[model samples]
Target: MDQEDPGFSAVGEVAGDRVTVRVSGEVDMATADAMFRAATPGRVRAATLDLRAVTFFDSAAIHTLVRLADHYPGALKVFPSDRVRRVLDISGLGHQPWVSADQG
Candidate 1:
């Protein structure tokens, strides 16, 4: 349906050693790069992705986060929405230490 549309955005903020990215709308192939750039605008010791406002989470989003975690180790964290949590679970990425599903 309309779910296959491109409608993703990300906003990043740096506070001390932590970089927080608040993402809204949908995340797909077309918007993944934008999300990555906004989420990791610069190097930081800690990173948090606020996905609570995201209406949709797709494979592109998952891949981006996984890659980030791989490169940054404990530098990445996620505050995922229930919708995103389900996707992670289905994708077998729910157990990732970088993902905090308890934020709900």
Candidate 2:
């Protein structure tokens, strides 16, 4: 989904100390900023980003996640798929502690 396509969107929820971000369709540069802010739920000891619904990801998405992790330090837990994981790995964002959604 592209910017002009207008079918992409991001939704989020938080349970306890973990935040769950569920994204649908493409998450490109244009949509990253809003998604990042939407996913972020202020100061939490742990964050569980649920990416099971994200159909696409790009550097912007990866960078956004990294920035959040950097901001919070050792308090970011990401749940991403293979495509999303590739972005995180390439961007060195996967080094952060990752906790399974079910674990929380």
lDDT of 1 by residue, 6-104 (tens): 456688999987888898888877777777887665657778899998888889888998877885787788999989999999999999988895783
User: How far is each candidate from the true structure, as Cα RMSD in Å?
Assistant: 3.3, 3.6
> How much lDDT does each candidate structure score?
0.82, 0.68
Model 2 C-alpha lDDT per residue in residues 27-84, reported as the tens digit of each score:
7788887777766768555555667667788888777877777765777666776677
Model 2 — TM-score against the truth? 0.71
| lDDT value for model 1 | 0.82
Candidate 2: global Cα-lDDT? 0.68
What TM-score, over all chains together, does every model reach?
Answer: 0.87, 0.71
Q: Residue-pair clashes per candidate, as listed?
A: 0, 0
Top lDDT prediction, candidate number: 1
Query: Which 10 successive residues of model 2 have the least lDDT summed?
Result: 95-104
Candidate 1 TM-score versus the reference: 0.87
